[model samples]
Target: MSAAPFGFFGKIIEIDLTGGDARVLPLDTALVADYLGGRGLATRLFYDAVDPQCDPLGPDNVVVIAASPLIGTTAPTSARGHMVFKSPLTGVIGTSNSGGGWGHTFKSAGYDALVIKGKADSPVWIDIAPGKIEVLPAHHLWGQDIHATNDELTSGFEAGSRPRALCIGPGGENLVLYAVVGNDKNRVYGRCGGGAVWGSKNLKAIRVQGKEKIQIHDKERYQSGYDQALYLLRQAPVTKRLMRELGTAGLVELINVINMLPHRNFQDCTHRPEDLERMSGETIAKTILEKAAGCYLCPIGCQRHTRIDGDDGSTQRGEGPEYETVVLMGPDCGIYDLAAITTANYRCNELGIDTISFGGTVACAMELGERGLLGAEKEGGLDLRFGAAAELEKLAVDTAHRRGAGALLAEGSYRLAERCGRADLSMTVKKLELPAYDPRASFTQALGYMTSPSGACHLRGGYAVSLAFFGGTKEIPRFSLLQSPIAIRNMQNTGILQDSLGVCRFTGYAFGSDPWSRMLTGVTGMDFSVFRLEEIENRVASLERLFNVEAGATAADDALPPRFAETPIVVAGEEKMVSEQAQERMRRDYYSVRGWDSEGRPTRALLEDLAIAPRAGRAS
Candidate 1:
């Protein structure tokens, strides 16, 4: 805790809009090492500064943008950034990960993180330069759409020197619970009501332009480690194909093989699986691609820049819908048009909306229609039936604008369903909608969704690697219901290790590779054995779970949607049911692995083992 600079830029910026004050604070390495930066660091700060029960869509909310140690360094796939805030949707800790140059740029801007609190008297924008910070009035920018705001900011600034900007649009200004902060026009720190936080703050944009360079502990070793990672990724089929072929969208076809392509919500996953093959990135390249795109320091180039011929003869050009957005907004909502799906994808990012939540909301409305709850009388007289592309597009626009019933839909799928008395129709974890992964088919993902920190999210620990990609399915290990619990608990611990390290979960496809650990060693010059790294990951995951428990989350919140647990999913003419008996066994196993009681809460002994000993202090 000395004043000497170390691995970090050795600084964090705290901004207070209510009092219009700003200050730089020294970095605490203890916090960095324990919390591990990015999501973990932001969560630690949140726990220390804000009350657990604070309303997420209020001026008192704290939003922190954090970067990891590997960011802006010679690490592969280090383009990830995080936006953390108390969630308006879940009323608990929420953080969203995004891929772009924002994180690195923010670090370069002379700070490792920005903790924003309070509200401006009027709409305003934050401008950060090499050595200047300004809070300018944004009256003219108010009510402008996301694209327009990006356009104005880019044009208003000097050419070829526009700072990276993260801003909320009308959706956020309206405090929509699913609102997000759109970055680079098409990329977003999407999910967990970030836009609503922006709205509550009377803030329009955060513009960062830093000329400072990141200092690594050992440049030679870092470069060597990075070269090894780059070499391995280039030779690896999964990484290369994902970059060259379809990007992450390539998983669309792979997951479909195991009946994991969610179609029409969790009610049914059965679909024309072959149709996925025709829509690969290779196919998109031939059909409608304009070019490929990537973020800063990223050689993988997994982002696709595409142009599709719209029905009106105009064309839509931007980052095409990735796998999760494509499925969640396309097949999950029962819409199938590729061009339409891409357009909707662009619209979601442009409107500062979370596609997963928005699509889940629309799907719930569609299901409600089947039950005679939503129709002309409700839903602003829009017939929210499944597979209606034009209607779906209209709904997307409406929700973005918060027009008519779109206002309610913009509250997210969970809240929308609750309003209609069909909450069970909405497949969600906490208040977040289920992502593209269907756990009924992949038991690993099922357990992940049920136990994730930020609702039903797959990225927490995408078990598809072990389950469908690698040896996870070799024998389909027939575990008696008695053994299923122990197996799932083991997987959860392994997954926690990866997330805590802030590495791409794809590295799990080659687990023994230890890509993240090697990068950590290279960057920090701290030799860490694989076993020690796994222990750190386990402890980090356990810490996050404890944070949730202290905030009142319980085993009751750990259960899946009634539909997912009670109903049978008939996929490809095969009936697959996630029985309650099976789920109970798995939950028990997960609890045991973390050394918790039958309930999912962390055990006192387990916390001590993780070195997060109980003390008279806040959860952080």
Candidate 2:
């Protein structure tokens, strides 16, 4: 095959940790064109390399680090990076995305993705600088937290260098299933056991730095599109001002206004006005937020830098308790103390655990306790009660150590609740805990969650909650069930395009596929039209569904937990629940659109049409 195109170096670095061998392989540019990049290409690569029957934590499970065509480009929010692996937590194909300097830095090292297979015989880490790869022993660094690990890896390097690292903490060392692989000590491959996978491999971190120049086919046109995207970024209400000024935490109040903010284990979606204010972005801004940070190529500084005093009187400094963390730890767990939430968020980051999973698990345990399930001696004299900010604080640390009740909590809400005989109280889908958005309140978002490839997730399916909470092409009525299926499918396709291109979702608010098409065509000289990108999205979505099916998932696994489908989260006089009838309608329409069978498996004809049937086994 000929060398890859301008925007893509078309290289994949495959490391076999079990045998301590590394190979630099040529990536298929045709596959790049078909899948686009990032999540799409990564999933395709994973399908080829993974065994559907392999345990997610076993040596057979494959992990791919996906660097998109847009990485290191001037494309707005193009700093995002992605990983595709089988999740130990959800027991499905795992796709995790994050933004920081890692993608750009690694791309600069002149490789497209890192495909790691097998396990290291012992704790190890890799340092990849331009033209060099060193596998070093990490036994001494094994137990360190994310921050400490980052510090250890970069200690000898000069200040303000371009090296980026992804590391796990004690959570991973001990195999917390919800462990995270943190990039830059803050932004993380935060969902679906990315860290647990790393732990399983006895791999601690991957640090890279490079200065290789990235080429663009049409620099002038690429610049123009980049400029247009930047202009639109400035014009967006959420991106330009709100996100830049208040960080993602700014969204806490907006979600609260819509009454979609989950509180007290989602038993109530709405909170008292005062309680809402207490956890509001404005409150965080005025109280603990020290600054707003941004990712590479992103003008919107929605990342937060926060600090607060701990009970021990020591200062705790950390990057966000982002909107999800704030609510999941605060309102969802019924802890309204901003400082407490911030502190807990700090500890979670250091421990390399997912805040969403960590806090949501605690919230579920709290509800179990409230329902008299804890029976007093709930492991280590635990006071698993809602509104206990102190316990919430302790929970993060204990969960990291997997101490007592923490061991049960570490299994995630689905298994934990099953053992507790309170599975009805667990708010999750396909085993992954839900995000801050309540499905009952955001009807379309709920539909997206049900069929999301990575289980009950917000981003992987689509962040349709955005269209309803804020303004969009037109106002979307939250209650209109009929508008949801098609709308969610379209949004999910758009999401795939965004993730495939390695751009931040925040910038997705400002522009559409037209500008993205411009970036793709101008840089790589591909015939990347808006229509073609949509097909690529459909192709990617179907491929992921097929992977899940090959792993034994069916329509029965596609429904929401009983909490959202059965119990109504009361709000103002309205008995609100995601009607089961509406959900069935949405699923049928979604499957029809994608040519999927009732079993949620992709049809042979549809696979052939997408031209992914052959590789529905190696691609970009």
Candidate 3:
């Protein structure tokens, strides 16, 4: 295969823990050309290596580290990475994208991606530098929390660098399926059980550092394109305000406006109207935000660094109570104390647990408590109620440590609910709990939550961006009852493309301005224009669908939780609803647009057009 200049490292690193072997493999340039990078590359890799029947937490499972052309670039918000794996929490494929210095470091470390497989018999940590790789024993670090692990590693190396580290905490050590790998303290590749996979492998952490300079094919042109893109981004009202005011937490109010905020395990979509403004992003920004931080070379620093006033007259500084964390652990779980929520956010960071799953799981427990399914005995003698801030923190720590009832909650809401014989109490898709948004309030996101490779999540394709960015109507399409299927497909395809590029979707606001496309052309000197890139994006989306099909996912898998279809939100004294027929029709139109059959399987012709060859077990 020819070298992929288009900002691609054109190399894949495979680590075999069982054999203690590592090798640099060539990335398929054809695949790179067709699928782009990040999630696209990851899906293709999973198609080649993993079987649908493989246990998600087993040694055979593959965890993909993917970076794209824009990664490590001067392009605004371009430093991001995706960690893709089959979810232990959910039986489905999952991809969790995160922002940090890690992607940039990995890209500059001379590899485009890392595919790790096979379990190690003993704990180990891999330190990958620009040209060197060392697999070190991690026996002593086996039980440390994520923050302490990062701290010790940084101090031990004496590199005078606080290099980004992705480490599993006690949650992962105890095999919690919802365990997460945290880096940049607060940022996480959060949704999937990648942490459990790491834990099972006896891998403590992956510490990476790279001093290698990023090389662009046409440095001058790249700089020019980047400058122009930054200008447009600065002018975008939402993007600008996001930078100046709330960072990404700005979405809190927007979700509130549509009454989509997942409150009390989604038994209610809106919080009490009086508390709306107090719990809004605007409030968080005004009250707690102390500063903003950024990663690597990005100019738009959307990460809010805040200090929350804890009880006992002390304070704790953390990354954020971003919209999702604020809603999921805050109002959703019934904790309105911003300080308490921030403390919980910090605790999750320190413990390396995903806030979404951690908080949602607690919300599920609270709902069960309210329904009389769980009381003192079931909760180990603590009153688990939504909005009990003290209990929220207790549960947070307990879940991380896997103590008492925390053991059950740590397994994720779906499994926990099943164990308690109240499956309806878990607000989730597949097995992962839904993020902050209520699907009944935003049908596009409902589709996003349901069909995301991961379980219920918002990152797959944020439909709120549809209303906020695209000239859509006042409300985010709440019922995928009509055009949502097609619109969602478009968003998913573009989302994959954006992820492949390893650039922030925030740059989409600057689309057509040629900033990112120019960076692509300049970095690798690949002759790509924005229009052609869109075509590649389309092919990548189709490729992902094909891979999922080969892995046994069918049209039946593309479905919302039954509650979403059966229970309509009572808003403005009217029923806001989505019907089965509407979803089916929308999905049908979506399939047609993507050149797929009624079963939502990609057609042979479509595969050929997209240069995706069918493997032996792939059904026609």
Candidate 4:
């Protein structure tokens, strides 16, 4: 027991589920200085803890959860937790982030990170507190839905101070490739099959509670940055008013306006104006929204707590159907019934499923059915048709339980389409399903998805749509090849910095890295200036690339599906498509800008220059 860093506990807990043994490892000051925390720290730890080619769902896979130094401070939306592991779905690095009390509480429990490896012989959950850790049996909690498990695990604590719980439901237990891990009942680590990884290890939940406070080295510097951040957030329309009024679903109408909205598995971005209105954010706000909420210490308040009428004539209350969920499940599936999408959204959350992937998978299935690909017998009598709103709710349940056709969908869209003998039909990149945005409308976005380490993720990529609309002076031409590669690289780096800092992505709409660098330096008494932060961002990006390369990724994997190049979507009255030539050029330029080789591997010299040592043998 030694004194920790000013802003960190400087401790990591490594738990072996096989023997139920836990050991405390001292966090290195150099590692903290290089990687900061959250995604970067977790990735560095995970890379050393598991073989690059290890089975993602096997005992050898490592799950690293880390908190940034900003978590226990007054930083806006600083409660995010970053989870890194090899993805069961994509077979690349899986980096997922979540917002809730869990990360904040986990840091409060006197540790900066928790690394779980090996597997339990039976169902279990981990309880963590200051100076205490336990691996407890959770057989009774097995097969329970997310809400129930959360309630059952978090009960009996003092009011307002209940320990936070992160758990999966039947989806994870069945090893659905796109299952999520839920926290705060609604907030989730909602991508890259983290839930399936947890399920494979027989982990049911992780409960944490503590009250340790982080020390700020310079209160004056911290307050200065905090004030500037708040002022800018107030000045930004998206953060100040739009999010609170309409939630992320507010983007429904806006994205449609930009021709970025996908319809019917991205056959085209065209949609009937009336249909868009039916499921738009305005409709949700006026129809079913119960209230707006925010994550721990967040001011944007973009969370949508709403109620929808069930087919059984009863009202059900739950969280979103966010913009991605709404479009992917509604318009992408050609289903405009808001109530049905909302109901299905609730089911996905309860079942611990990633709604974005599930929706994309369903849309792919529908496209296959339309093209006479999904055989009637293979469908198990399910509709599997676009605009089949009646079947959306049932699909959620079936997918989670691996029942009927869900067994195929449980493998995700790539496997499902490949099973149907049409791998090209799957709207995916690197096996992870695409989000709601159609990449054809924006070359920068298309490049982002092509180069994103996590595959087709807007957040993990660049969220380039934000630049098109709300990037203020930072906005660039969406279709400029000369500008897109560098622009997207910078955007992705900004995202890396934000994720590593445990901050929200939406904050980019208001401000950039300066305020965050100030706040981080103020709290940690470290020189996290903009230049140093950029270096760290490049280091983390290259490290992630190194992991993917060792895991068998190549330049070919950095590509969009053929549909983007084969078909055209009209943007601003001009037909647009990301041609193979364009993709290759952008990909090559992106690799060059990232200091990677043309084959998309981090060059030895570049790695050495970043001071990133080559991966060593697995850690004990």
Give the TM-scores of the predictions, in the order they appear.
0.92, 0.96, 0.93, 0.98
Please give, for residues 1-620, the per-residue lDDT of candidate 3 as tens digits: 68655576778888888877888888877776666678777777766777767888788888888887777677776778888777788777777888877888788787888888888899998888777777789988988888788887766554545466778888777778888887656677887777888888888888877765556789998888877887887787756656557776677777676667777788777566567667566787788889887766656677888887756788778788777888889888877777778888888877778888888888888877777776443746534777788777667788888888778788888876776678767888767888887777666766666556555766674444454323445443455367566667667766777787777766665564367677777887776688877777767667666656756778876766667778888655668655676567766777787789999888888888867766536564
Each candidate's lDDT (Cα)? Answer: 0.72, 0.84, 0.75, 0.91
**Which is better, 1 or 4, measured by TM-score?**
4
lDDT of 2 by residue, 1-620 (tens): 66786888888889999988888989988888889889988988888888877899999989998888878787878877889999998888889999888888889998898999999999999989877887889988998999999988877877766488888998887788889988887999899988889899999999998877678898777787888898998898988889867777777877777778998888877677787787677888888888887988778888888888666888878888788998998899988888788888888899988999888898988888888886533765544888888776667777888887777788888777787777877788888989998888877888888999998889997787665546666867666677777788888888888889999888778888888888888898878889989889999999999888888788877788877877887644688887678788788877887789876788888888888855432442
Q: Write the per-residue lDDT of candidate 4 for residues 500-572, one digit (tens) a residue.
A: 9999999998999999988999999988999999999999999999999999999999999899999999999
From the highest TM-score down, the ranking of the candidates is 4, 2, 3, 1
Ten residues in sequence with the least summed lDDT for candidate 2: 611-620
lDDT of 2 at 475: 65
Residue 3, model 4, lDDT: 57
TM-score of 2: 0.96
On the 0 to 100 scale, the lDDT of residue 547 in model 1 is: 66
Best by lDDT: 4
The C-alpha stretches of model 3 lying farther than 4 A from their native spots are: 4-6, 156-162, 375-383, 468-480, 615-620
List the candidates ranked by lDDT, beginning with the highest.
4, 2, 3, 1
Off by over 4 Å in 4: 1-3, 376-379, 468-474, 616-620
lDDT of 2 at 352: 81
Task: Report the C-alpha lDDT of model 1 over 531-569, residue by residue, as the tens digit.
Answer: 766666666667667767867888888878888777777
RMSD of each: 2.9, 2.0, 2.8, 1.7
